[model samples]
Target chain A: MVMMNKEDFKTILKKDKKIIDRAFEEKFKDDNPLNEALRYATDSGKRIRPILFLESYKMLTKKSYLNDEIIEMALNIEMIHAYSLVHDDLPSMDNDDLRRGKPTVHKKFGEDIAILIGDSLLNLAFENSLNLAKNGQRFLDASLYLSKASGIDGMIKGQVYDLRRNLEIDLSYILEVYKNKTSRLFMAACVMAGLLNGLSEDKLKALENYAYYLGLSFQIQDDLLDKNEKNELNILSCKSLDEANSLLLDFNNKAKENINKFKNNDFHIYLIDYLTERTK
Target chain B: MVMMNKEDFKTILKKDKKIIDRAFEEKFKDDNPLNEALRYATDSGKRIRPILFLESYKMLTKKSYLNDEIIEMALNIEMIHAYSLVHDDLPSMDNDDLRRGKPTVHKKFGEDIAILIGDSLLNLAFENSLNLAKNGQRFLDASLYLSKASGIDGMIKGQVYDLRRNLEIDLSYILEVYKNKTSRLFMAACVMAGLLNGLSEDKLKALENYAYYLGLSFQIQDDLLDKNEKNELNILSCKSLDEANSLLLDFNNKAKENINKFKNNDFHIYLIDYLTERTK
Candidate 1:
């Protein structure tokens, strides 16, 4: 297997980011309040989720290029992510005014439009998924995987637990919050790649495990880096800084181990380190 | 054709409402905050959208009974409608303190949970739709139809129009808002029924027209009956009360005519009058 250096990883991610950004540009060209705010909310991100999806698919298919349907599916995942961030920033939620160095959706558009923007983005994600599914059964499975990950059994449940954080919190409860809120979508990204490519059930399960560990470690790293005191569900609340770091290291190791069975997995292995070891 | 009186209409509606309510009761049996608030948000809706879907399907299949998948799809439509109402009643949106003689979701369970509830319900709607679609191709088509009807091309766009109501509006603008916000879901209900039953494009077009006219008349009647003055896009703003009433009559007649071609459509025909002629 060919090993990829950090520069190669950056190059591939940049190319993938360009693909996602261009798709968003083309899809949201109309100048309306909904599209404007949608474009604004989705404008700039690391494209981490879509990149993970694309890399997973590439690892399996050995294809350097992807079809529009695959890219559209990845964009749908990003749209779900974008919508979550938009709603999370609402005054009644996280109540942040700034995101990505600009006013959030509710701050730029009115709260009504901001709420609709989030709802619209989520609906649009499924609309695109359904359209992609019309192509074949694999797409349908992928869409279902995504829908499950984002709904009550997954991300939404995580958000609910996070909101009720003050009620008899424990290490298990905080871990549950991280697993559902963060890891579910990560699992969706990877498992969707497996579903779309018709990977084996064994491989799909492995991908899910990889994503779960990756998500937990990445979230813990986020909490570690965040200077804000509002996150009562942070790992530090349950474990000391040293304990959190050791847990992060253990999770990062597990994440790499899960993907080691796949060929040409240097990028995936490096990704665990990159995501969980971010600088301030 | 079997001619039905108001008693039969009430009987069938009550039966269908029971089906929906029981499904909700079963689905939301968990006592967590999310399920509790979800049940509260969806508890007493009139089950209008789902009923429209079931009746349209019955019109095509001529079957007195439906399967669980079909019922689930119908429930999904209601879930989407319920989510819309929850979000619409948020403090940032319509700001209603009460709905159906009970506290709104945001009023009863804080604004944050209400937002998550709306997001969860919408996500849950598509999740159920995707699950139902796994039965066959027809269900997939039905799911796609519903998705488009609820997204930016449909309900969300209508909301944006409603939010931007003060922007140099006119009769056409108000009608645009009504068509998208009100009629789109009605169209989805009927069109999904047609799709699931493999109705010809001609019949689907007829169903679409029927739903459009029915929704317009329904909204006009609602505006006519509402004693509040907050609706800037109410038809009465441009038309006299007599003129608005005449227009409602015209749309109601059109609605009935579109569905008249189908045999055993008395229930559908009566639905228009039942919805438009609600007593204050």
Candidate 2:
């Protein structure tokens, strides 16, 4: 396996982020109030989902360059993420006044517009996918995988479980919330890599496993970092911080193990390292 | 064209309603809380959108039977409508406790679940569309049409506009709102019939025009009936009831004109007649 150094990793991340940024700019070319509000809502983010998506695409397809259709796929995932964040921050939900060091969409542009912004963003995600359907059945095939990951049995269900957080829940139930809330969308991005390029079944299963561990590790890290959360409180009360960190390390190690099973997996291995060590 | 008696029209409505009811039942066969909530929200509507969808499809294709793809297409429309109502009746939006003489989703399921219900329904609509994409590119083609008609520039924008309802707005502005909030989805359903069956440009254009007028007449009738809306209140204050009815007649006349342009038009004409004359 060819290894990617730190510079190679930065280059990949920067290029992927630029593609996603360009797609958003192009999709929002028309200046309307709804678009304006959507722009504000999606204005800032780490773009982690798109990064994972593009990297997975590259790793599976062995293609360094991405096409408009694939880029749009990445954008749709981010839009789904953006909209979920917007809704999750609403007064009736998490009541978060700030996100990513800026005021939440609801706080910036009234709650009503925020709701519409979230709704519009969700619709736009599908709009982008349907637009890509002109390319072939593969994009359409990938989109089914995507919508389920975002829907009732996936991310939204996780949000429901998260919102209805209970203090009495044990580690097992909290893990269920983490799987839905944090792991599913990430898993979709990773699995979409193989689904897009028609990766073999064994390799595809490996990617899915890779994504599962990646998501689990990421969520445990999130819980460890968050200063205020009912599950966080429950987590800390149930186990020691050191124990949580040990579990996270175990998941991270498992994520790396899946990556190592594939040929030409240097960059993917680098990605796992970056995510596991990511500060925020 | 075979001219139908009132009994035939009633007969068609009942049969179509039963098909839509079956589709929803089969779609929501899962007994999860989320599906249960979706079932409750989807139940008891007039099922107008799906009825129009099937009627339009039948008129264009001259087919008596609907495959699962077509039925799924119809279900997607009703899901959009159902979810929109669920969101609209939220405390943050319309705050209505009752809909169709039953407690609203939020009232019965709680606000967070209501929000998830709406989000999940939206995702399910796309999931169903993605599933139907396997039938052919036409379903994908129609899905692009469907998403745009539901997205930022369409129904959601209209909802934003409606939420910020201004009493000072004129009839022209109200018409714009009606076109976005009401006409686009109905127009999508109508135009999709031609898109799915690959109708000629002339026929498709007529379908669009037909839907435009259908939506206008329907919303105008809705406003004319509702005693609580600001625009309705404004209309009552500004003009005589007879003058408002005259405008309704003009739209209703325009709707019939478009339907008459089609060759196989008996039931389409009857559907329009029923919509305009129905007391409910």
Candidate 2 deviant stretches above 4 angstroms: A166-168, A227-234, B166-168, B228-239
Model 1 residue B252 distance off true place after TM-score fit, in angstroms? 0.9
Alpha carbon lDDT at A106, candidate 1: 92
lDDT scores for all predictions?
Answer: 0.88, 0.81
The native-contact fractions of the candidates, in order shown, are 0.75, 0.74
Pairs of residues clashing in candidate 2: none
**Tens digits of per-residue lDDT for model 1, B28-68:** 88755588888888889789899999998887899989899
| Candidate maximizing DockQ | 2
The DockQ of predicted model 2 stands at 0.76
Window of ten residues with lowest summed lDDT in model 1 chain A: A226-235
lDDT of 1 by residue, A1-280 (tens): 5779999988988899999999998988876547777888888989999999999999989888899988999998998999998998898888999988899989999899899999999999888887887888899899899999998888888888887776677778888999988899899999999998899999999999999999999999998998476755788876889998999999988888889878888778888988976786
How many residue pairs collide in each prediction? 0, 0
Candidate 1 interface CA RMSD, Å: 1.4
lDDT of 2 by residue, B54-130 (tens): 98898877777888788889999988888889998888787889899899999999887888888888999988888
**Model 2 Cα lDDT, one tens digit per residue, A75-174:** 8889999999998888878888999899999898888788888888999888888887777877877888889999988898878777776657777777
